[model samples]
Target: MERDFYTFCTAMKTLDIGSAEGRGMSPQNYATIRLALAACYGKLSKGRVGSSLELTSEQEEHRERKGRHYCGLKEKGKRKDHERICIPGVAAAALSAVVFARMRHSSLEVLLCGLSLFDVLVLSSTLLIYPAMNACQNEPDPTNSRVCHFFWRSTLIAYPLSLIAQAGSVWTCVAITFDRFIAVFFPIKKRVWATPHTSTYIICGVAFFSVLFKLPAFFEITLNEYGQITPSSLRLDATYQLVYMTYMYLIFILLIPWTVIIVLNGIVIQKVREAYRTHKRLTQRNTRGRRDTDERKMTVMTIVMTGIFVLCNIPPAINNIIESYAPQYRDRYRHRIPLSTLLVCVNSASNILIYCWFNRQFRRSVFRLCSSAAYKRRASEYIRASKEASMSQTLKNKL
Candidate 1:
């Protein structure tokens, strides 16, 4: 069968070329189609083709169907894993935000609150919107269903929102690191600069700029009249891919943040160690020593957060670079993409655990918050019981 198909392809290349030229088709178009046909033939004969020629419509559709089947079988476990992690991660992030907001102990809590909220946005989008979009796309007639239409439009909106949220999360980490850096290196200046108001302003600025920067992503995918999700022409531009997707993302999102976090974290860690050593030498258990210990713990927490951010994000960064420069190998590394996304989900979700583990104050606050809620519930129940007993006594006297 393969030999017969190859022979037919050869005949078309030789005979159809002349007929195609006579039928007023341009030589370039004819050549492109011929190359596509050759690639298809090679696939059947050799089990692989490396031509990179633009596939004909039928071939493209076939490839997409095959890829979908491959993913369904291979990615079932990954989808399950995503569900396991993201649901709890969203809850944890929300809990962390509430706890941090109630604390109001320092500017760091404000930054942490912002981080937690942004992480909620990230994890929620990943959990709900993207998965919904994927399920809608898998339908036979996605356009015919109102639910699919809603999710299709939601996905376009969600794409930019997710990017904005992710950017906000990244810059919030940067802000937290910078705050620690200032507290350690410029203790006298920290009072002037690292106020809650300053932190709020920084959070607002980061949010505004993140939206502005990711606004283009809104157009990256669009629903066509037929309700099929398609990449916009802007997404297909080679210059845009190279300049915006490759260079700009690498520089702004990965390189700059990574450099700032790593360098500042190292210096802050060293300063913290020096302070600890000095306190030990003094052999003082005074309020000053306690303050130093709290500061050191905060610094350690900041370092751990930044370290996790760097580690979790590294795979995605590498994957992005690979897709940008060596796209031919994308299929080979497709499994890694889901793993990278899992790492990001874990990073966003794991901050609460980090806080609980490293910060004694955070754990105490969480315990107090839970206990307070429980106390209120119990008080309400007692009041209701007392009111019912008084009503019964009144009713018995009337009888």
Candidate 2:
């Protein structure tokens, strides 16, 4: 069968070439069709020898180049990597942002603002760059315009915006932790930090500071002739790699912020424990139990969110630290970046779930929002039933 098919294709090729020339087809068009036919023939004659099976040096070189993959192009075994991560992350972030928008007036408004903002940033950046990222993962052609343009734009431009959003998210958590600490340890100052207005200011300040800090990243990235993103020529220097890259990630982004989060949350937990013990001793009644339950729920929510943030961020943070010192690891780290990004998106998106789980008020609000139309329909039905009953009674009285 293979031999027959090969002969058939060979015969078709000769006939087509001869016809192309006779039919007044341009040399360029004929050449293209010839190459296409050749490639098709190559597939059909994979195991056979002679003209079809023997690839030229140049052809072999092209094949080798196609096989050459960057880390971003790799998949998790046979599974798709980017779509699995980016799509879900974008969805979760969007849902969380929408859900949390209703709870803006709460004491935790500042944290919610930060979280929602981060979600929006993630949504935008992910959507803007998802095509490019997906293409880079799946397609080999670096010359793809959408891949080059969107990927470079996302990485070089939108990425820094995401960085600011991320920093704001971190600082927001830090602020919440600190607020909880103050509320527990120093009650008098709780009013100052935990207020909605104060949270707004803090959120704004975080945004401002993050923009200021992440500005350096914008200048450090550039696109090559093929539209692939690479570090700036200036960033090739040892000083930039050692000082700015290393310290920027290790000290400022990861170490200090993470340390502050851990310490503050730890204190908040300790204080919570003390309060629980005191509350238990003071009241054996169910009323106090309800309050205690509420407190416990909030504590659980905070812990879960903080835990997820830390866990999801660990890989990227470690890579940052390592890549800071050893520049060679940067390429290897790119392979894992999509996974890291997915983790962060999940973390950002899960906050709404945590809110619904932990806060009764939030749950009620969400329920009311979701079931508002149903509630109205029920009310209208009840009114109609009452009117019908009254009319029946009136007619019966008249009779």
Instruction: Point to the candidate with the largest lDDT.
Output: 1
Off by over 4 Å in 2: 1-102, 224-228, 282-296, 328-333, 372-399
Clashes of 1: 0
Residues 1-399, candidate 1, lDDT per residue (tens digit)?
544544445444333323344446887886776666545434442345653246677876566444434333222233467778889999999989999988877889999999999999988877766466445544444446665677767777767787889889889999999999999999889989998889989999999989888888987897665664667999998998999989989888988988888988988888888987887789648897788788888889889888988999899888998899998666556558768878888999999999999889889988898899999999999999999999999999999
Per-residue accuracy of model 2 over 31-135 as CA lDDT, tens digit each? 776665544434433444354436787875454333222111233244344456556666655555555565666446556657667766865665566556555
RMSD in Å for model 2: 11.2
Error of 2 at 189 (Å): 3.1
